[model samples]
Target: MKPVYVIANNIISPLGDTTEKNFSLLRQGVSSVRLHEAGNRSPIPFYASLFPETFWQHHHTTFTKFEYLLAQSVNKVLEQASVNPAHPKTGLILSSTKGNISLLEENAITPQLKAEISFTQSAKKIAKHFGFINTPVVISHACISGLVALITAKRMLEAGLYENVVVAGADIITRFILSGFQSFQAVSDAPCKPFDANRNGINLGEAAAAIVLSVHKPLNDAPILLAGGAVSNDANHISGPSRTGQELFFAISNAMQEGAVSAADIGFVSLHGTATVYNDDMESKAITLAELQQVPVNSIKGYYGHTLGAAGLLETVISICSLQENIMIPTKGYSTPGTAQQMNVCTVLQPIEQEACLKTASGFGGCNAAIVLKKQ
Candidate 1:
């Protein structure tokens, strides 16, 4: 199979609007957590990593918050890759766990609401924006949505279905999501401290991110190739994470197998450290079982919070930026070691001229995913 290349990437999150600004703040160990005042009963006392609500109020109208943010991210990525929608061979793959439920609720409450927010509706809006004749595929696979979308794009290219594909994933924090995390006691009142001994829980945030994937494009100065990726289900529990590390073990081993690389060759592991007790414990156990001890690992949840569906793509963009700049971002709020694992979680900022990076995510519905990226 031909190598899949990440030609370009862009993101919109609470940390900052542009990719460069977010990465700059990440390198500085800045935390974006702030008090959430929705004036409604929330499970969390105060939430971290929230976007300026004014941006949404001013920039979007008439559509669901998900649609507006998704469109904005897609436009930015297209502009970066110089891909014109007028091109016939291009395709789109959109991933989101919450498919406009914010609007779904709005329509549900008001009987006059014409249509509920659906995958087809979002696809039509995005396709109309690009004037594309084909319908875009919308995928919802819990938190692994973004990386799964990337895998879909690679398959399309390998099948000779399209010369290039645009992969986008987005989800906004809403009353529904906030309540669910609170139900799990996973919403932290304080800023998230991933991999820290004192780490409490995750902070919720909203984000939209997009990337351009191609097979024949010339390798750019910092071409981050999609070496390998896999999504698997633990089927262990509906909400509780598995402590045996069975699923994550499969994901890591599969990624190495597909990339033809050893666990030791992996420069860093961008872990799915959610700052929750179960998630943190399970992820640590998995890494240890894989024998990836001493591999530097970290999570960006402290910076952007958990962006849900968009977390995978947004964090991948940050990972790519780290590779290009030769700087590894510190785990923003980590103050101490949480578990008795041998893996080297990034406690302080460091620099490395890395050639490859591994990104991982595990979410609700017993889903887990991992991907390998290489610097050109």
Candidate 2:
């Protein structure tokens, strides 16, 4: 298979708008999550990371908040690359669990815009805004949406279907999403502590991220390669993950095998640490099953919160930056061991010489995905 390289990328989060800015704040141990007062939609005070108020003032647009985020992220990448959006060989993939679902509230006021609430419709509109020629591909696989979208693009490129693929994912916090998680008792009142003894639950967040992949490498000093990816489902439960973590282990092992890497080769692990009791536990068991207990691991949930569909891609980009700078950011809010299986969780930002890292994510419906990224 032809190797796919990430030539350009961007992130629009509460911390910043560009990848460099975000990484700088991360290295300073700054977090975007904060306590937000309840609104008319959600009448409960909760913790989350929202885009700065000045963000919209700078990037003025008529699109909804969700649409603006997706468009802005993609626009940033296009600014740095020479790829033509209208080229037939170029493809667009949008990843989101709920695209403009918040617009449903406005249905009573403007029934004519009802069709725009569909995820597919929103995707098409975004593609048209960028003048993409081909139909946009949409991935809505819960939290794994971002990773699944990247994996899909890799397959498309390997099959000679597209020369360049742009994958963007974003999800904003809404009343519907907040209430649903609240009902599940999964919304933490305080900042989430992943792999911590006193951890409670997850704090929702909002962000959009994009990455451009191609067979040709860009003219840059640092280059990252997407070596392998794999997805698996345990069929254990709809809302709960596999109790034994075997299924997640399968996906991790397969991704490493396909990447021609081993447990000893991985420099660190970018975990899907939602800070939930079950999620952290399941991931630890899976890592132990894969015999990667000694590998350094960390989660960005405490910094960005859980951005739903955008979490995977956002963290992957940060991990790539970590590899380029040879520094590993610590898992924020983690004070002590919290999982049954012990693993090497980074407690502080450390500089080390490493080549490759594993990015893993598990979502609802027992879905799990893993991708191996190597620094070139």
Candidate 3:
């Protein structure tokens, strides 16, 4: 299989706009998470990373908030990477769990708005906005959608289906999502504390991220390779993950094997540490099972909350910043290791000496996915 390099990336998150800008803020331990008022999106106030309601008012657009974020992310990445969206060898992939689901709040959903609710239609509009030549592929496999999109792009590149792929993911928290999590009793009252003993639940956040993957070497940053990726299902529960984390371990093992790397070679691990009790514990078991107990692990959920479909991609983008800078961002709000299996969770910004890193995610339906990145 051919090697796929992350040529250019953009993250339009609450932290910052560009990758470098976000990384700079992260290095200083700055976070965007804050207490947001209930407004029309929830019955109660919640702690989450959100742009102000009027953040986009200056930029009038016909696109919905979700599509606007996606377009902004893509436009920046394309401009930075100089990738031709209209190239026949280039493909576009959009991933999200709830695209335009917020339209339900309207008094009456118009036919046009109803049509825009479909993921494919949203992708079509985003593609047309950028003059993309191919029908964009959509991945909505829960929270792992972003990583799954990257994996899919890698496969497409290796199969010679595309020379370059723009993998973008965007998800905005809405009343539907907030109520569902609250119904599950999973919404945290405070800033999420991943892997912390006092951790309670998760904070929902929204973000959009885009990364350009290509067969050619990048002209700018360190040559980061999306070397290996694997996805798995534990069939444990519809919402709960594998009790033993064996399924996630399988994905980690398979990913490393395919990447031609081993646990000993990894520098740090970007986690799906949603700050939820079970999630932190399950990931601990999975990492230990894979014999990565010593690898420094961190999560950005404390910075951006759980970004849902965009979580995987958003975290990956930030972690890529970590790899580029040879520094690891701490798992914000984690003051203790609360998982049953024990994990080496980073509590502060630390220097990193290695180049290979692993990123993992587990979502609803007992699904788990992992991918390895190597800097050459």
Candidate 4:
């Protein structure tokens, strides 16, 4: 397979608008999650990370919040990449679990806007806005949507279908999403603490992240190579992950095998630590099963909360920066080991040279995905 490199990337989160700014905030141990007052639907205070009110002032448009995020992220990458958006050889992939789902609210309902509630329709609107010649590919695979989108982009590039692929993932915090998680009792009243002994539950967050992948090298610096990726299903339960970590372990092993790397070669692991009881446990067991227990691992959820569809890509971009800078940021809100397995969870900033890293994510519906990133 031909090498696919990450040529450019952008992140629109509460921490900042660009990748540099976000990484700086992360290194400072700053967190964007905060307590939010109950709105019309929610009756109790909840914790979440949300965009500042002034964030949309400059990019005002008729598009919904979700669309605005996607457009802004894509626009940022387009500004840095040399690919032409309208070129036939350039492809666009949008990843989101709920695109413009907020429009389903009673106040947002209107005859003309009704059709926009469809995820496909919302994606097409963004694609058309950017003048993309080909139909945009949409990935709505729950939380792993972003990683799956990247894996799909790699396959497309390897198949000679596109010279450049723009992958963007975004999800806004909505009352609908909040209520659903609340009903599941999966939301935490306090800011989430991943892999902490007293860790409670996940705190929802909103963000949009985009990355440009291509066979051509980047203009600024050497590109990070997407070496391998694999996805698996535990089929344990619709909403619950596998009680045993075997399925996720299979994904990790396959990803490493396809990348032509071994467990010992991975310098760090970007964990899918949602802070939920089952997720953190399952990931710890999976890491140990893969014989990567000693590798430094950290979860970015402490910094940005869980960005849903954007989480995977957002973390991947941050990992890429970590590889470029050779500094691994600490996993915020973790002070003690919380899992049964003794995996190395980064608690403080560590500086070291890293050649390759593993990024893994497990979402609802028993879906798990892993990808290997190698510094070029």
| After superposition, candidate 2 runs with Cα above 4 Å error | 58-62, 109-111
Expressed as tens digits, the lDDT of each residue in 1-376 for candidate 2 is 9888998889999998899999999999999999999894479899999876677775554577788899999999888777899999999999998878887765564655677677787788789999999999999999999999999998899899999999999999888888889999998889999999888999999999999999887677778889889999989989999999899999999999988898888999999999999999999999999999999999999999999989889999998898888999999999999897998999899975669999999999999999999977
> For model 3, how many clashes?
0
Candidate lDDT (C-alpha), each: 0.81, 0.90, 0.90, 0.90
Of 1 and 3, the candidate ranking higher by TM-score: 3
Candidate 3 collision pairs: none
What overall lDDT, based on C-alpha atoms, would model 3 receive against the true structure?
0.90
User: 130-229 in candidate 4: lDDT tens per residue?
Assistant: 8999999999999999999999999999999999999999999888998999999999878888998889899989999999999987665656899999
Candidate 4 TM-score versus the reference:
0.97
> What alpha-carbon RMSD in Å does predicted model 1 have with respect to the real structure?
1.9
- Report the lDDT of model 2 for residue 159: 90
- Using all chains and alpha carbons, the TM-scores for the candidates as numbered come to 0.94, 0.97, 0.98, 0.97
Worst 10 residues of 3 by lDDT: 53-62
In TM-score terms, candidate 3 sits at: 0.98
Error of 2 at 39 (Å): 1.7
lDDT per residue as tens, model 3, 1-376: 8989999888988887788888888888888999988787887898988877776785555788889989889999999888898999999999999988988776487887778788988899899989999999999999999999999999999999999999999998888889999999998999999999999999988889999999999876578899999999989899998889999999999999988899889999999998888888999999999999999999999888888888888889887888888899988899966798888999888988887999999999999999999897
Error of 1 at 18 (Å): 1.7
